[model samples]
Target: MKGVMRFGKKGKLSPRFIGPFDILERMGTLAYRVAFPSNLTEFHNVFHLSMMQKYMSNPSHVLNYEPLQLTPHLSFEEKPTQIRDMQEKRLRNKVIQMVKVKCMNHSKEEATWETATEMRSRYPELFGTF
Candidate 1:
C-alpha cells in the first residue's frame, strides 16, 4: 500500500513526527478537565492540518500557556517583575529560534547501534551480555 503526503512549493514537507498530534491531544484533555469536573473522557481533538501549521509557525508563543496569578489587590513592584519576565521569555524565544535553524540544517540521526556500543563500553553492566 502507498501513502500520500502533502508538500509545499519549495519542497518543504509536513512534519513527519506526531508531535503536533500529541500536543493537541494534551490540550483537549486539559479542556475537558476544565469543562467537566468529573468522569472526564480520554478522547481529545488532536491537531490537524490548520491547527498544527499554526502552532509550528509560532511554537514558542502557542506552546507557552502558563497562567499568571495575581491577587485582587496588586502591588506596584509586581508589574515590573512581570515585564522583566516577559522580556526574558522573548530572549529565550530568540535563542530557541537560532538553535532550531542550526538543528534543521542537520538532517541526520546518529546510528543507534553506534550509540549503544559506546554506552556499553561506558557502562558495561547495563548493556552486558547474559
Candidate 2:
C-alpha cells in the first residue's frame, strides 16, 4: 500500500492520526491486521505496530464524536460556515482580494485565507450579494 498524504499542508501541521480503527488480528511480532470502513477498502488492512494506537475506551468520546459525511473516496467537503473578514491587498498596480473564511469543524486559528474568486465558485452562498 502507498503512504498516506497530508491534508492541506505537506509538513508537521498535517494530521498524523486518522482513525481509531478496529484491530482484526495480530500478525507475528510487529504487524497486525486492522479493519477499515467500506469507503477505505482500497487501503491495505495490515499495518505495523508502530502505526497503531490503543484507543482509550471512553463512551463519552463516542457520544461527542461528530461523524462527517464522507464521499465515495472517503473524503468530506468543508463548507464555509461564515465569512470572518475580507481584505484587499494592493500589490504594485494590481489589487488582490482575499477572504478569511470560517469552515465547519475548524477553529478560528485553523480558518484559512482563500481567494475571493475561488470562494465564489466553490461556495456562492458565502458571498451573499457581493
Candidate 3:
C-alpha cells in the first residue's frame, strides 16, 4: 500500500479519514446520520458505521496550520531570503555552478539548491554585483 495512489492522477498523499463528526442518529443497522461542520457543506451528512471511529478525549493533537500575512486575495508568494552555500560540479565538458538559497517562511533545512545564474536572474538583490 506504500506506493498506491488515491487522491488523483499525481496525488501521493491525501487525507483518508477527515472527521470527528457528531452522530445525529442511527439510520439503520449500519448507517448513521452524521452532522458535518459548516466548512464541509459540500459533503453528504450520512455515512456507514464502518467509516467511523469512536471519539476519545486524548490530549495528543496536531494543530491546524494557517498561513499568515497573505494579500487581499489570500495568497502569498515565496521569496528568496538568503544564500546558504555554493558549489561547482565538474563534468566532462564544463563545470556547472550551483547555489543553495533560503526562502522566506521556510525553515533552514527546507532551503533549496538553485543554479547561480537562475537565482541571479530571479532575485538580483540576493547576489548584488556578483
Per-candidate Cα lDDT values, in order, are 0.25, 0.68, 0.64
The lDDT leader among the candidates is 2
Mark the regions of model 3 whose C-alpha exceeds 4 Å error after superposition. 1-76
lDDT of 3 by residue, 37-120 (tens): 655555477888887887667689653433333344323345778898899978999998899887654567767777888878
Q: Output the lDDT of residue 118, model 3.
A: 83
* Candidate 1 lDDT tens digits, 10-101: 22222233222223224443231122212223323433344343344654555422222223331111111100011111363452111111
Give lDDT: candidate 1, residue 126. 40
* lDDT, candidate 1, at 107: 28
Residue 96 of model 2: what lDDT? 84
Q: Write the per-residue lDDT of candidate 2 for residues 34-99, one digit (tens) a residue.
A: 887766676678988987777777767753334445555644556678888899978998998999
The true-structure Cα RMSD of candidate 3 reads 8.9
Backbone clashes in candidate 3 total 0
What is the number of backbone collisions in each predicted candidate, taken in the order shown? 0, 0, 0
Q: Rank the candidates by lDDT, best first.
A: 2, 3, 1
Q: What is the lDDT of residue 24 in candidate 3?
A: 93
Candidate 1 clash figure, as a count: 0
lDDT of the structure predicted as candidate 3: 0.64
Best by TM-score: 2
Clashing pairs in 3: none
